[model samples]
Target: MAPLRIQPMPTYMDIHEIPGGITADEVAKAHAHDAAVEGKYGVHYHKYWVNERAGKIFCLCEAPNAEAAMQVHREAHGQTAEKIIQVEPDVADLFLGGSEVNSAGAVLLPGGAADARDPGIRTVLFTDIVESTLLTQTLGDDAAMELLQIHDSVVRDALKALNGREVKHTGDGIMASFVSAAAAVRCAAQIQRGLAQRAGEQSNHPVRVRIGGAAGEPVEHGNDIFGSTVQLAARLCSHAEPEQIVVSSVVADLCIGKGLMFRPLGEVSLKGFDRPVHAHSVEWSA
Candidate 1:
């Protein structure tokens, strides 16, 4: 499995081409069947969209695997999915928060400022919420929103403290960039540690974030960051346990003797990487 993932697990946005047009009642029946039996297959039917005039419908789900997402519909409702594609979400803060980053990809200290854009060499960071769907189901939208707000605040505060540039939100996660790999790693640890401590003493709805990072130049497009570095960071984040921080070899190399502790997990296979990547999990035990 690719860790706990930003959206809880691997997600597939399924496409259904309904030649006869799907009806509201028919969709309801399928949803009911899913609600009844999805747990059997370790899947969650997130939602669906209907285009009656065009005879097209889109279904969203979080499943252990694509096969599971397909099997649930095949066995339960006979609506075999035409396609199951893994997807990433698009989310970001209204604006970038923290001190400005310099042209040389250096973070200005607090109360300092710099220019607007620099897609230069940077340490990209990613973090995700665990089992968020279940949280939303347990607590209504209103309540879940409350917890998410706090999570955003905590993340933003940590980024500000470290002078990280808030790139965007990833639905249940956040993406930020740092000029220094050590700062990024330390900030990731801080986010996890602080949230863990708070979850320990707070309300019944606990919060956890999986943190991961990689170092390299990233391509900025469509107001979002991309390229292999960002993807690898997210892949590592998905491989991280709740309240855990994982970093790539690039990050590990950059943080050596920087007073950061990392345990090497040896060569491990990460999705989309040509070969297994040697990764390290940040040790955060007190």
Candidate 2:
């Protein structure tokens, strides 16, 4: 008879929403409670983020199932989570990055003082060279390579200025993550504008690109950042016109009062998503 295989428990990110607000100390006590009882349920509560001003707390844990994870909370402090989403541990580490955890298990900013908490929210951005294959076909290998270099230079420069981190290069595009949604939007705009100026100078290549951005936690379904947020950003990028910028509604909402302009694209159908996503077009020209 073949031996039975035991599957690994999944990692989950659970959100807790308090009415007024919550403090780090309060969450620390709650986390201590959870840790004391989690072993009984075969669950492990890892780290947590507390947005004191926003009255939100995000806890990362591993359990046999969502119910098992919640049961630990229910038995410990009676403060059930608002929602729990399974996430890919590797991808979460990639996007959210690692942080310093206090003895209480609350995540803190990487080099910041004890009070500076890391929110665990991130903005994901993608940039694709419009008609990259055709550009290569028409411009020849050497010229296409030159234009690609220009794209890399401009995007990396913008990322550096806006504090964005390049996750990976996608051959024809780039994927990046930002701690601030406003910074991500600004970075996208800077890239588009920079490319436009470069296009005018290098009229021969006239490279044009499209950008898309979305904001969300690190919850994901696959090894890669195929999380809904990342997927929406990629879909919006493909849906954009040449030299244009498109972003998800949450990105727009997060950029409110940041002096950016976005025209509503309404709800648009996107591949791999069950429902239509509301998108916005960022005005980056001039």
Candidate 3:
């Protein structure tokens, strides 16, 4: 089955504390813009309530990941949330229980059942050098080593600028995680552009990197994250062409207003996934 046929899941939820208070008109306006902004990135948002006395608002959204939800909030009104959290797909149904079952098994109703799972979301990024073996053969060990160092410098600079954490080195590449999808996408584009610039600056080894991004609930164990999301991101990197940035449908949806453009590649078979994944190629130049 194609991913488009599957039910959409609510993966992120956040509570914004409006210390100054908010109005119905403001909520209505935000919701109207959100409907358009988030749909491009592949999510849905509904304003639940406005606590006038406490000056708070609760919002529920179905997003590919936490970054997408946060992006919508940030670009919509500059009201970037203080904290955004991941909602377990199963647990989402617990709060929205009324009649329609949320992606989570729980129904939406009064005194809704509480979900036991933890909530938080992250965007995982993976990148690798293209044809390293061939490059090494042509450039020799000493030249290849220097090229590797250049790659490290460029990527490390991007990580620092975007506030991303380098999880580990995957020999010819690296795996990193970000709190924001916007940041991750921005970092990936910068890395590509940076590498292109370096290729022109140095005449020795012109290296191109392939990048893949996916957002989801990632379980952190030590320095590494082990989950379907991580695996999915890694698979995407492997499938990408040199200097190309590939992303899942979730990533594409979350990145709608972030200045990057995506060209749809349609639903394609990815390793391990039972259904075809909807993938996109980031059009960094345009």
List the candidates' TM-scores in order: 0.58, 0.78, 0.57
Ranking by lDDT: 2, 1, 3
Clashes of each: 4, 0, 8
* lDDT tens digits by residue: candidate 3, 123-208: 78898999988889988998888888888888989988997778778888878877567788899998998999999898566878
Give the per-residue lDDT of model 1 (tens digit) for 111-202: 42443222234688998988888889999899888778878888988898887888778889898988778889988988887787778878
Candidate 3 regions exceeding 4 Å error are 1-119, 219-226
- Model 1 — which ten-residue stretch has the worst lDDT? 90-99
Estimate the lDDT of model 1.
Answer: 0.72
RMSD per model, one decimal: 18.7, 4.3, 16.6
lDDT of the candidates, in the order given: 0.72, 0.86, 0.71
Give the distance in Å from residue 136's predicted Cα in candidate 1 to where it truly belongs. 0.7
Q: In what order do the candidates fall by TM-score, top score first?
A: 2, 1, 3
lDDT of 2 by residue, 43-160 (tens): 9999998788878888989999999999999999999987788887876676777667888898886545656888777889999998899988998999899999999999999999
Number of the candidate with higher lDDT, 2 or 3: 2
Give candidate 2 regions above 4 Å deviation. 1-12, 16-22, 37-44, 52-55, 61-75, 78-90, 109-116, 220-226
Please identify model 1 stretches exceeding 4 Å from their true place: 1-119, 219-226
Evaluated with lDDT, which candidate comes out highest?
2
